[model samples]
Target chain A: MAKYLLLKHYRGAPDPVNSTPMDQWTPDEVTTHIQYMNEFADRLKETGEFVDGQALAPEGEWVRYDGPGSPPVTDGPFPETKDLIAGWMVIDVENRQRAVELAGELSAAPGAGGRPIHEWLELRPFLSQAPETAE
Target chain B: MDERLLRSLIPDTLRILIRRGADFASAEDAVQEALLLALHRWPKDPPRDAKGWLISTAWHRFLDAARSEQARRRREELVLAEPPPGPASGKDDSLQLYLLCAHPVLTQSSAVALTLRAVGGLTTAQIAEAYMVPESTMAQRISRAKRKLAEAHFTEPGDLSTVLRVLYLIFNEGYSGEVDLVAEAIRLARELTKLSDHPEVHGLLALMLLTEARRPARTAEDGRLISLAEQDRSLWSTTRIAEGVNILQRALAQDSLGEFQAQAAIAALHADAQAPEETDWEQILQWYDELVSQTESPIAKLNRAVALGHAHDPASGLAALAQLDASLPRHTAASAYLHELNGDFATASRLYSLAAQKASNLPERHHLIRQAARLSGTDANGPWPGSGE
Candidate 1:
């Protein structure tokens, strides 16, 4: 089996089929969208596909090492320009096809007016343990 | 009293309890309690009918558990309607039990732990020891898996591939503490052979046997991985190799070739060679061709590239490698080797160092680093003092 990272981006991804943001949606629509995401995770847990999922905080900073015994340098928590990761769902699945199928479903989480978001999610494969027979 | 025989009877007894109205969790508990009782009592007074004894004891334990529950009214009704325990559907129940434990609803690790306990008939302590987990942790994992599948009704037969995958995972876990997972997997596969005559089951057993035969030579004294060509063939287990070959031959003769059978054929070719130079690379390439056609796995393609390097010229191997995605793990290492074979030592050295940087395991990373150093005419422990600025 292989693991995949289903990444949801806050800004980098293309526009969704349903373009309205969650904050602009009606309260009921927002509730429905949240419920949809929760239900999707629950179903994945039942299917033994879910490893973990979480909504990331919007604020983040970049840090880099300078040298030995040197204080690390930090960059701004650029919320406007940087390609921010909204959150991710990590899944262990039977194959890449299954991971894609699951990502497609996650991308369909309800958006404005409780319509399918049809968001673009970046599906990335996790590098697995090296095969034993490899030299 | 035969411990293995008693353990083998566990699934049958558990099925009897479930059919007689015990819930899955309670049935498992009852079976476990009955087994513990047998361990203590059977030595002093062995029973003539071990299966019957286990079934009866487990049934009583199930009833006791139900009676102790708060829903006494429902418990009494179930007890009244419950039929006397009879011999379970024998082979069918055992096979179904295997599928249930390996249910898709359970995680791989959970399925493995459950299979070792519920179907393989090993104790929780034994399974925990084998996996090198605390008993409580293994217990929680098994219980969580059981709960996840509690509502799963087996209207359709369990998938054979899933069961095989779980068993293969077990075999891959190797040995730990007092338990040998490899031996345990072989035992479970042998049991599976009795329950179902699926060729793939036999194929799996053969594959495990063949690969395990090389375990003694798989690692060097310092725990570094040894490539097959560099392994000391004298250290290989002849007995295991013979058995594996015999099983593989029987499977291949069936004319219903599957992926595992093809893989076993490749392993068999390696075991057949007396020395690395004598290896039948051409025959191995044929098996790889079959494997690639049967399963379009990238891993298979990577391996085929390695075989191509040996079967043909290095240029041909590099050409084949070019067809695959360079992003695949170990792609650089394979490229480096082909370059080295073609006398492009500088490029090979660079690629080896790049591969070392990306290596996932310490042993493999060290091996790649050494390869890079040797190609660069530097000492493995450290670079030569005047080698670089």
Candidate 2:
């Protein structure tokens, strides 16, 4: 089995086809979206595919070490200006095709007006344990 | 309790049982049962003769199993059919087992799994965990492989090259979960040498040993790939290097040269050097030339170019690489290295990033991206502060 990371972006991605802001949606709609995501994770766990899922706070600051014994420098929490990561779910599945199929389902999570979000989720494969016979 | 020693005896004992009268499947099951019994009993009461003990125990297990399944009349016939220990056969049955598992009808994956179980003496659960497959799946694969081996009507021994290929694949998988495949491959290769004194068998063992000796130096503390030129020589295992070189010399004395021998020769040169600058790239390039001609493998050719770059001019190396298909996995990486050597950091950095994107493994991708960052004058000593790297 191979592992894949399903990334939901807060920004940086090209505007998703269904560009409805979560805050603008009805409270019930937001609840539905959250439930769909939770259900997806639960289903993956049942299949022995779920590895982990985590959400990130939108406000993030970039930091760098100045030098030894020096205070580190930090940048702004520019949530709106830069592409921010929303959250990610890691799954261990059979193959790339299966990973894509799951990603498609995730993208179809309900949104405003109870319609599919069509959000573009980034699907990245985890570099597996190196197989024999290196090409 | 010297489980490895017990494991080594597994195939030989199984073969002995089969030769006496036991069917292959029954014999295998008996051997497995004997091994489990050994694991439980050996530590408390070690066997004076492990192989003999296993053989007798497996034979008894086989008899018991056969008797339980059939009538008393058939059990008596099985007892009568059993052969007493006699002078060893000129052709070792263990060798036959190798040939059987390496049968060409089986795919590489199946052959590897079968050889690990029947020949290398790994348990199905251990093999499954190593390959990240379910135990049931690996069990099925091995059974299917054995069935395929049984069905193939090989009038003579199967291809020795196929056996060597499977062993090499197992070695390359390295250690994960319960199985240390590198050690397993080395153990199997050593067994192969005992059964058949073939030069290529020695060559393959030597190659694996020489390469594995340098494994400790192949990665940084942070798990990034360390190029040969940068690795600390002190970390290389001298004992394994000596053994590998000794084996290679003996194989060379036989004068039946093969691709594995040539590859080992290259590895030996790398191992022999005190420092990267002391490497005999000229001799390495010559060995790679022999390797390219013998195997006609693109990976060998790509490596040959890298050796060419170290031995001669970067331009010459680039010229050789240009002849290769660009779509090849390592082509961009090779080009980037050669370009970097030629002092074209601009192109090198770009190509390094491109190679990073195309890399199949995390360490390799990180290494490539680090190379790009270094070339582009970006501070890479700090932790990766962004998502991509």
- TM-score for each candidate, following the candidate numbering: 0.66, 0.72
Q: What does candidate 2's lDDT look like per residue over B284-388, in tens digits?
A: 999999998998999999989988998998999999999999978889999999999999887787787677656766567657766776675432222221232
- DockQ measured for candidate 2: 0.03
Candidate 1 retains true contacts at a fraction of 0.00
**Model 1 residue B382 lDDT?**
22
RMSD of each: 19.2, 15.4
In Å, residue B350's CA in model 2 sits off its true spot by: 1.4
Could you tell me how far off, in angstroms, the CA of residue B78 lies in candidate 2 after the best superposition? 9.4
Candidate 2, residue B360: how far the Cα is off, in Å: 2.3
What is every candidate's C-alpha DockQ against the true complex, given to 2 decimals? Answer: 0.01, 0.03
lDDT of 1 at B375: 72
- Once fitted onto the true fold, the runs of candidate 1 whose alpha carbons sit more than 4 angstroms away are A1-135, B1-6, B19-21, B36-57, B70-73, B76-88, B132-134, B366-389
Best by lDDT: 2
